[model samples]
Target: MLKFTLKRLGYMLVVLFIVVTITFFLVHSIPGDPITAMVQDLPEETRTVYLARYGFDQPLGVQYVRFIKACLCGNLGESLRYPGRKVIDIVRNYAPVSGVIGGLSLAIGFTIGILCGILAALNRNKWPDKLIMVIAILGTTIPTFVTAAVLQYLLTVTWPIFPTTGWGQAKHIVLPVLCMCVGPVATYARYMRSSVLDTVNQDYILTAEAKGVSQFRIVTRHIFRNSFLPCITMICSSIAGIFSGSFIIESIFAIPGLGKYFISAINDRDYSVVLGLNIIFTGIYILAMLLCDILMALTDPRIRYSNDR
Candidate 1:
């Protein structure tokens, strides 16, 4: 176990380095003059100063070496568009809003999804099951941006049932959070339904029924636990994505979350913000995968990492 964990940690570092290196080169290689774009309004002397200070005047190799060093030392550098503001600081400020949205969406989505899934499974081919399946298909097939647009149009533009956009107040996040959770609702419902169905056919379940076990006791005691493991596996595997805010959802709602700022940073060529956030996200995903594997092994004795004695 220790050996596996060490190997995974080593891989994480390598992946993080690759992400940083790629983001650095890609952002720098973008079309047009980033320096001029950033300091277009400044005087020539100030522009030169800004260029030198930020290594905009340096060769790519030199800039890359310096950037790597800064990253190693936990300095993510300042935002190019907003001078003197650290990328880390920006993440700290905006990440919570995204976390809140993601957390709420997952909580609500998972609950509703699981309940509907259990309902569908119980009903089998009845109307409720068929209707839920249709909803699940549509929800999963539809893009988040499309969902956001339609909701925004109907709830805000047409009916004024909710605030048009922007964050603050409970009502503000309703649409975006709902939109973000659509995928989860579809995903969980489908997976749980399948899982429940499969569990229902297991020999233990048949034996329980033959032994005169009540339906509710059989389902709640045996099937629910077995059926939910796969869902946990999915959640563990996708933990990193939980905080990524589904990209454009925040923007559609005009929320000042990390994902929305990330979009702006890319458009404005704010190298520090873009690179830092990307690396952070990459690290999160890699680490989450490692944790997921470890968790699976711990939770299921049937699982093994290697041939170690």
Candidate 2:
């Protein structure tokens, strides 16, 4: 396990290097200089001084190397648009908001999805199953922004049950959470239903039944355990999906989160913030994948570490 973890860490580092390099070059290649954008209001002499102060007068390669070095030294560079604030400071302030919303949505979605799936599986070919299927289809088909807008209209605008925008109190989170939950819940339900159905039909399940094992024991202890493993992998991979969903939901709801910062960075062409946020998110994703692999090995004895396998 140690060796396997080390290998994965090495791979993650390599990927991070590639991502950083690509992002730096690509952002630099974008039309219109950030220095020009930042200094547009300044006189020509003042603009030249500002550019020199920020080292914008340096060659692109030198700038890239300095940026990489600064990042390595725990400095994500000062934001061009926001001047005195470091990119890292902005990220630190916003990440927690996104984390809270994303984490709550994921938990609620997964729990509801698993319960619904189990019920649908148990009631296959019946109305309950059909109803769940329709819900799953709708959840998967609708775009997240569309769902956010519609929910805002129905729950916030028309009925005024929830606040329309801005995140401060818990009340502000309700609509965004619901919107983020839609696709994940639907996807998880369908996956869980299929897994349960397949597990229930396995030969071991039949043998357990023939031996007169309690139905509850057979289903929960044996079948559910095996059935839920794949869902774990699916859930981990969906971390990226959850974050992406939060981007739209957060922006629409005016939540002060990484999503809002990300959108602002793009619009303002704040490359430091954009690159900093991207790297942070990519680190999170990689860490989640590693955790998923560890959890899989721990849960199923059959899943041996690479050395053991």
Candidate 3:
């Protein structure tokens, strides 16, 4: 297990390095110059001075080396638009809002999905199952921004039950969280329902039923627990999606989060922030995968020991 973890961590570092390197070059390759974008009002002579000061006048290879060195030294480079502010500081300020929004959405979505799936599976071919299926389909089909706008119109504008935009109190979180969770919740519900149905037909489940175990015990203990392994794996991957969803939802709602920062970085052409954020997101995804692997090992005895052992 230790060796496996080390191997995964090594792979994660390699992936992060590649992502940062690609992002650095790609942002630089875009048409407009970052210095020009920042110093639009400055005279050409002043812009030239600014470019030279920032080493933007150097060759691309030289600039890349300088950027990498700065990154290694814990200097994410000064924001091209913000002038003196370091890119990392900007990311740190906004990441918490995204984290809260994404975390809550994941929890609520996963719970709702699991409950709906269990009900649909147990009531297979009945009205309850049909209702859940319809909801799941709609949830999957509708775009998140469309959902957010509609909810804003009905819940916030027409009814005035919730705030239309901005994040501060729990009330502000409600709409964005709902919008972010809907798609994943639907996907998770369908996956869970199918998995449960498949597990219920397995020989071990039949054996448990033949032993005269109560139906509730058979479903919860023998069926649900065993079937949950795949759901657990799905949940981990779903977390990455939650962060991506938060980017869109945050933009729509005007929430001050990492997503907002990401958008700002793109508009200002703050290459350092963009590269740093991408690296941060990639690290998060890899960490989540590692956690899932550990959880799998804990839950399944077959995975607990090294294959070589």
Candidate 4:
């Protein structure tokens, strides 16, 4: 297990390095200059000072090395648009907002989805199963932005219960979170239903039934436990995706999250913020996958971590 973990860690580092390198170069290659974006009426002297100050005067290779080293040292560099503020500070301010909404959405979505899936599987070919599947399909087909808009209209315009936009109060999070939950819930329901169906038909399930195990006990002790293992991987991978997906939701709802800032930074050509956020997103995704692997090994004893053979 240790060897397997170490190997995965090594792979993660390699991937991170590649991502950072590619992002840095690609961002630099963009047509607009960040310095100009930051300071509008560019005086020649001021431009020179700005270039030197931010090390834009240096070669691309030199800048890349410095950027990597500074990042390794926990200095994500100052934002071009928001001068004097570090990239890490911006992330720190916004990540929690995104996390709260994303986490809540995932918890609610997964719980609802799994429960519906279980019910659907148990009542296959019945009306209840058909209804759940229909809802799931709608949820999957609908775009999150459209969902957000509809919820905003219903909750904010017609009813005026929740705040229309902005972050802070608990009420503000409701719409965004609900909007976020739609797709994930649909996805989880489908996956969970498939897994449950496969597990239900297994020989062990038949054996439990033949031995006259109570229906509830067979489901709780045998079906749910075994079937839930696949959902764990889906949940883990979805964590990172949910975080990224919030960009649209956040934008639509005016939530002050990494997603909103990420979009804003790109439009403003804020290089530091863009690169820093990209790296953070990539790192989270890689770490989530690694966590998923660890969880898979832990949940299923049949999954052994072996470096050899």
Which candidate comes out best when scored by lDDT?
4
TM-score of each: 0.81, 0.88, 0.89, 0.90
- The lDDT per prediction is 0.83, 0.83, 0.82, 0.87
- What is the per-residue lDDT of model 2 for residues 1-309, given as tens digits with 9 covering 90 to 100? 777678778888889888888988988888877777755666778877877888878999999899889879988787878889887788678777888888888989999998889889988989999999999999999999999999989997889999899877989889888888887789889999999999998999999999999988997888888888999898786776445336677778988887777888888878777878777778778888888887787777787544454
Clashing pairs in 3: none
The local lDDT score (0 to 100) that residue 146 gets in candidate 1 is: 93
* Model 4 stretches with alpha carbons more than 4 Å out: 1-7, 36-45, 305-309
lDDT of 3 by residue, 1-309 (tens): 887778778888888778778888898898877777765777889888878988889999999898888878878776776778776787677777887888888898888998898889989999999999899999999999899999999998899999999878999999988888898789888988998998888999889988999999998889887777788898788776544436678888999888777777877777767777777777788788888887787766677776316
Looking at model 2, report the run of 10 residues with the lowest lDDT sum: 238-247
List, residue by residue over 98-172, the lDDT tens digit for candidate 1: 888987888898888988898899899999999999999999999998999999899988998898788889998
How does candidate 2 fare on TM-score? 0.88
Candidate 4 lDDT by residue in tens digits, 1-309: 777678789999999999999999999998756788676789989898889999998998999999999989988788888789887898788888888999899989999999999999999989988999999999999999889889989998999999989878988889888888888789888888999999999999999999999999999999998999999889887888655547788888888788888888888888898899899889999998888877777767677434423
lDDT of 4 at 15: 99
Residue-pair clashes per prediction, in order, are 0, 0, 0, 0
